[model samples]
Target: MILRFSQLIVGLILFGAGCAVMVDAGIGLDPWTVLAEGISKNTGIGIGWVVSITGFLVLLLWIPLRQKPGVGTVANILVVGAAMQFTLPLVSTPDHWIARVAMFIAGTALVGVASGIYIGARLGPGPRDGLMTGIHQRWGWPIWAGRLGVEATVLVTGWLLGGTVGLGTVLFAVLIGPMVHVSLPVFDGRARRRRHTTPAAAVGGLSAPGT
Candidate 1:
């Protein structure tokens, strides 16, 4: 239990730091961050606050979906944005394109690794992640379809609201799925044990053992 809790905290911190790294890379951001950025720009709130507020707002949506929040879910809503707030001041964008690109790639990879660590802890899904999975279960949609629909909607809305979108956006879209796919087993010990276990069982469901 201690180990799982540690993993969850570390993962959330790393995830937020990764988002900060990508933002500092000055290229683009993940879809959810893009929305946060847009909201921050429009509302005069700090981006970190926007992130936390967005998380809580998303959690509200979970009620109708009958989704239950766990310790990690609540922690996710608080810690991730706080980590980002702490990280952004310490990091800066490189002037060179190559360095910027490297930061973007590293950031994306860290986010994937973080996802594996926290999800493997089996506490609960983050607010946005819960929404995606809930949509999948409720509507009988493929997970990919649900993710794509949610992400695309946010991406477009963020763009319309004046968020930055660039080659990094394309790169993130192309790389994140595969990155998380490959990284999951490395962090998820239970998943590494079974060759045939579905990702849903390995990472997504509410029935996490020993949780």
Candidate 2:
């Protein structure tokens, strides 16, 4: 339990830092971050603050979907944006195109890894993911359909509002799923326990020998 909790916190912190890294890359951003950037640009608010607020607003939608928030859900709202705010100022946009591309790739990979780590902990779904699942629960919508509808809407809206939209967005969309797929089982607590359980250990736990 302690380890899972630790993984959750660390993963979320890394997730926010990864998002900041991508922002510093300035190539593009994920759908949610793009929207946050758009809102930040218009409101003169910090992008991180916008992210947290957006998460909170999304969570509210879950009420109608009959979704429940957990420790990880609440932690996600508070920690991720705070970490992004702290990390962003430390990173600057690189001058060279190659450097910027490399930075974006690294950031995307980091976000994928962070997603696996926190999700494997099984504490709760992030607000955006929960919203999609909630939509599924309420209306029997396919999760993919829900994700597509929401992301496409945000991406277009963000693009209209002056967020960067480019090759990085394309790369993130193509690569994140596979990356998370590889990382998830590696970090999953159940998988971890299964790996640690040797044949002898399993046998020892059974009532075999005379007591």
Candidate 3:
């Protein structure tokens, strides 16, 4: 339980931090966020609205994919949107181009960290990602194909909506995969330690209830 809770915290932190940094960077942002920012800019809707609408619609798509929603899925939808709405403004870069670039890099890197932790938490995936895997499973598509299809669609829609797709988008696509690859292991080690300290039931070899 402790391990799971820690993982949840780590995951949320990473995800939230990523959103914050990507926005403040003032360059292009992550793809999904790229879409949200685009909608916000053109529609004059709040960032949260854009995020929530996308997340909710993604989950709606997931239902047809046979992906049952869980706590992580629920949290995934709202948490980032809320965090983005709240934190993006709080995270800002200085006037210098170098400073803006630094913020962008840091924000993107933090996204990698967040992706790793949240995934390692073994919690449900974020709504968009969940939709990707769910469609792959339900439609008998390859993981790569499914992911690409979803992302491509989102990217286009977001662009049409007015999201900026620039260096930030490209950098994120290349870097985050490797970042998650590296960081999740450190968090997995922490989870393993917490599990070892947790007592299990002697009779059935299961964890105690509420544990």
Give lDDT per model, in order. 0.87, 0.92, 0.76
How do the residues 98-187 of candidate 3 rate in per-residue lDDT, one tens digit apiece? 787777888877877877777776767778888778878888899899888877887888888788788878878887788887777667
Q: Which regions of candidate 1 fall more than 4 Å away from where they truly are?
A: 196-211
Candidates, ranked, TM-score: 2, 1, 3
Order the candidate numbers by lDDT, best to worst: 2, 1, 3
Residue 70, model 1: lDDT of 93
lDDT of 2 at 128: 94
- Candidate 3, clashing residue pairs? 14-114, 38-162, 38-163
lDDT of 1 by residue, 32-134 (tens): 8888888888999878778899999999989888889998999999999999878988998899999999999999999889888888888888999899888
The C-alpha TM-scores of every prediction are: 0.89, 0.91, 0.83
- Kindly indicate the candidate among 1 and 3 with the higher lDDT: 1
Worst-scoring 10-residue span by lDDT in model 1:
202-211
- Candidate 2, residues 1-211, lDDT tens digits: the string is 8998999999999999999999999999889999999999999999999999999999999998999999999999999999999999999999998999999999999999999999999999999999999999899999999999999999999888888888889989998999998888788968667666766768887433321
Best by TM-score: 2
